[model samples]
Target chain A: MDTATTVLDLVGVFLNALLGGTVARRDRLDLFGFLVIGIASGLGGGLIRDVLLQHGPPAALTDPAYIPTALAGTGVAFLLDISPPDWSRAFKFLDAAALSVWASVGAQKTMGVGLGRLPAILLGTITAVGGGAIRDLLLQRVPAVLQDTRWYASVAVLVAAVEVLGIATGFPVAGTVAAITLGVLLRIVAEWRG
Target chain B: MDTATTVLDLVGVFLNALLGGTVARRDRLDLFGFLVIGIASGLGGGLIRDVLLQHGPPAALTDPAYIPTALAGTGVAFLLDISPPDWSRAFKFLDAAALSVWASVGAQKTMGVGLGRLPAILLGTITAVGGGAIRDLLLQRVPAVLQDTRWYASVAVLVAAVEVLGIATGFPVAGTVAAITLGVLLRIVAEWRG
Candidate 1:
């Protein structure tokens, strides 16, 4: 939980919430809709993280940072009166960004929780995708990860690879940095071309 | 868990899905919407169960029974297509039924997880409320639990109390029977009176 990581997680949650609320707002949702998408995306990662770790609720109810972070994000969306076409492109960027950070953070978090390297790698990937998956499912939309053909699974796979490689080679910092960069860059490139 | 408790839990989920989807269709939400509500109410309890257990994705994912059961219920709803009414009344009953069942099942399951009576009670209440809370939040409606004062919390409280007392007194069968009957009767009475 480095300051950088903590900030990243918070930012990740906040940004994800902002984008999720804004985009989902295009639908027929109302005030509570905004809150739902916000919290689902913001706390979704850690909630999945906790579930994978067998810790349950994943600090959602207990963690004040998450709820307020989501709340603030949703507020931004409501003020903006978002629609689908407005941020489709921006959403892609946000998705890319969330994927990158989540990959790295999720992996390291797995390690911190005392999971073996393999489980940690898997957990990291789950943490990254699980939130969005749940959100989409709740919205009654098919999950992007399951539908996309652009190797969406690779982002998670590569992150896990980096985690395993980092641990095995004792270049944890370097491995993580490379892994994060790969994720961010890949996601960005996908979004750019997409 | 005792055989009867388990049976009731499963049946409650199946029944709620039927009831919920029927209500959804009456609202003109289409197949997808009905499915959403059906699955949401059905998995609502287990989602909370998994979250509390830190098992993540709920047992619904692991157990093949959950979705199929819900889908079957959804089909029934489609076929039955309960007559339309004011959205408000249907919603109230949906919330009430789900809450009652969840309160009972959540408490029983929490105790089964080996948690203390207090956590079990709290978890049960949360479990009962959690799914609908999430569902309504996503739908942009104020959650009934947060908005109403009638017996939302009371039902959960009563269910948890029955489960705990049954466990403590070594009279679990009687306890569970009382819990279910009490929840249903109370909900019916509350709805009728109000």
Candidate 2:
């Protein structure tokens, strides 16, 4: 992965971990719960994608930066209560950004491994939504992505498709940028419409 | 990796898929739901273990037999009611047997890969209980093994430990047999007492 992608990937991990921590706080779970949920929310998607690729140990494990970044986000959430009044807008932005980065990175990674287009798109969508899905499952709820109203997963699928198209067309960098822009825009619009 | 282990592992997949199918049936899910649930229950554990090991594409995908076996189990449940009136005893037996075999095979596989005892034990427990945990999550329930009364996860932990010890002591075959026997006995006892 390039430096830009690496930075964005770590940012996604941090942001999602923070999001997971918010859920843990809402549930009144203890620190351990926050840690577990945070790690799952941050790293679960990439982990699933890498595993499916039959690649080496997941980047989440092999890369030193990922776990600590997730922990830092978790710590912030645990130590400070970013109440709903101050959270909604910022949360939405961060969530959307994370989704976009993950989708692009997932598709690119699959392509890097020489897999076909179908696997790339599938993995990209999975990489974007899987963490949240696992988090919801851990909390004993139907995944929000599976719900009719969330539209988060729809955005991921669209982002993945764009990334795949970009890579196929020999403009990987531009493709990632365009996909991310589209994802964030779509997610924000969906929330606004809701 | 051996023939006997391979046969038992596939058997475990089939049995767990049937268990997942039973859950889907109770939920009144359609055929697609059955296939989804069955595949998760049958293949989820091995997929998880393989992903964690970072060895190769999960055997569930690489080995064609795995998918078909899971489908067969789902097909049986979908085609026949196997109502609770006749399912309870058989269900318990099969569940216990599946658990025992997975626990043994998981630990052995980990050991074969030259990982330490802890990972082997952890993977073993995960392999034994992961499919059921995932199946429960998909049905929007807290995993049974995590509940106070299940004792299922506890059995898996014990089985894994035993396998680890056996492998360390160079008695892999005997260890697996002993672990399986112990797991089944303990599970049956737990159910009986309940």
Q: Chain B, model 1, TM-score against the native? A: 0.78
Under CAPRI classification, how is model 2 graded?
Answer: incorrect
User: Which candidate number maximizes lDDT?
Assistant: 2
Error of 2 at B152 (Å): 8.9
lDDT against true structure, model 1: 0.70
Error of 1 at A151 (Å): 5.0
Collision pairs in model 1:
A56-B54
Task: For candidate 2, give the lDDT of residue B25.
Answer: 94
TM-score of chain B of each: 0.78, 0.94
> Candidate 1 residues B14-111, lDDT tens each?
66677667668756788888888888867775786666566335767776777888788777888785543533665555555556667767777766
In terms of DockQ, which candidate is strongest?
A: 2
Candidates in order, TM-scores: namely 0.59, 0.60
Per-candidate DockQ values are: 0.14, 0.20
- Where model 2 places Cα greater than 4 Å from the true spot, the runs are A28-36, A71-85, A88-91, A148-150, B1-47, B54-125, B128-132, B138-140, B144-194
lDDT of 2 at B71: 98
| Tens-place lDDT digits, model 2, residues A50-110 | 8788777677756668878898988998998965447678777877888998998999999
